[model samples]
Target: MTTLTRPLLVTLVDDYDVVLTGLAHMFDDYRDRILVSEIDANAVLHDAIDIVLYDSFAQPESDHEEIAELVANPQARHVVVYTWNFQPELVQAALDEGVHGYLSKTLPAKELVEALEAVAAGEVVVIEPKRRAASAAGLDWPGRREGITDRESEILALITQGKSNAEVATLTYLSPNTVKSYIRSVYRKIGAESRTQAVLWGVGHGFTPDHHRIDHWLGGP
Candidate 1:
């Protein structure tokens, strides 16, 4: 591991406040190594940031344009994608966009800090897939308190946006069968009998994203 003179200045980027806040707290134990400078939803990047960790919750995994925009930003020294999806195409696409790291959400806080330290030292990091029974702790998402896993909530969010199962699978890099399985789980947990009812429930809850990160950052309409 690279020894830093000081803690690396990091920023968390995502549309959901809950998700950002949870990620920020995950590094609380490793404050000496990695300092979360800010959690941004729509704010402009004014200060210099060593790394910007883009959390890919409820977002299309293949949105390379947004990643490219982030890479082009001068204030962001390095960009890293923090996500659960590890499809080879998605990884290659993100790397092609000049991302410094493509990390998994399944990584624990300590390992996450280590990965960031490696990125700070100018090494491109790509976390390999592991057979994890559960994702890392100290993370939160919309409807998590209501027993909805992050993946399930993401599926519901896409469904709320009127995405068909096939579209959801495409965007999330999951199989169509996996998408259906997640939908079934979501319906069971939310007491919904059909797609319409599930969409209604998702609408009532916080399934929709507040704004797109790049648009909000660029102050576009």
Candidate 2:
């Protein structure tokens, strides 16, 4: 049999032991190719883990910084977060942190498995649009997202076309960090909280076109 090398490693943290144990078990079946570790909240893993599924442990955690740090790490290219609930703001925060995948505690095992593998392969996974957000609270772009200068708008348009940041940096002749910063600023200004949100808001506001049709975002500024 052809064996997969390097099991996908995961770390779990939660206040409830039972919950942590159950999670460890659920993912235990992949032991041969998926190593699972349950660790204390304060642990900063020395070896690279395939993903981390965590919740409150010893203290109230700061979400964005942690997620961003993981994404920023060369070893954490495939960071995935699993949470008990999907809060739009929190979920968006993870996206801004460059998280690769996220699934609510209620996601089906089959789907979760697919998501884990996808993220491990370096693809980002997005959750379903929040019910309320679709109804009304979705997002609003009051004016041009504040931090984005004119040059940044040009870059944002490129990303909307599915271009990678590196590709954008090459095209714009700007540094990768500059591109990332622009995206973050756009997110902040539009109350976007996420890349998807930034895209939706930009398209909604006329920075990017719908591409579905020729209708103006809000039919005009």
Candidate 3:
């Protein structure tokens, strides 16, 4: 008789419902290998999870307090960061926080599943995807439909959250000049001429962080 392995139980974390919903759909075809147990936003887990994949949408990166909190969760066997930024210092800091994985946002769904399996097996995985002009298919963010790239949308989200340019650079591991470039692009895309205007536009367009808990896929008890 042949033995069958059970799918790995995983939870997706992000501040936006759209972002987490898109991420959950990416694993639809790989249900045999990975089971999405929940889609949450800074909420505590009620059930045991093999991996907690924290999506760094608008939130601060590696050094953020939330990452440390997740690392200390007893229900989460392993904590991983799913982000677009992969500077060496950021990666090292995340590892130092006890994260099991630091994966790039550009990874294809299939590759992402493989990476999660590796993390579950106790391997420290850090994958920096090749430079790409766009995010992977099946992924969504706040301003994606408005012709904003994922990176630009992230900057807008941070700005909406009252992050200054210097703070944004620190959180994203981007240089000040690069951050300004992205801000300019976001301004053009959203028809905002000033930071105040951009922030107002962001506020009405789902850029503000959603603090309420969400169980998008698996209903909470």
**CA-lDDT, candidates in order:** 0.82, 0.54, 0.84
Clashes of 3: 0
Deviation of model 1 at 169, angstroms: 1.2
Which run of 10 residues does model 1 get worst, by summed lDDT?
Answer: 212-221
Ranking by TM-score: 3, 1, 2
Q: Give the TM-score of candidate 2.
A: 0.48
Judge candidate 3 against the unseen true structure and give its global Cα lDDT, from 0 to 1. Answer: 0.84
For each of the candidates, the C-alpha root-mean-square deviation to the true structure, in angstroms, is 4.4, 18.0, 2.8
Clashes of each: 0, 0, 0
Q: Give the TM-score of candidate 1.
A: 0.89
The 10 consecutive residues of candidate 2 with the worst lDDT sum are: 212-221
Clash number for model 1?
0
Among these predictions, the greatest lDDT belongs to 3
User: What would the TM-scores of all predictions be?
Assistant: 0.89, 0.48, 0.91
Instruction: Name the candidate, 2 or 3, with the larger TM-score value.
Output: 3
Superposition error at 155 for model 2 (Å): 43
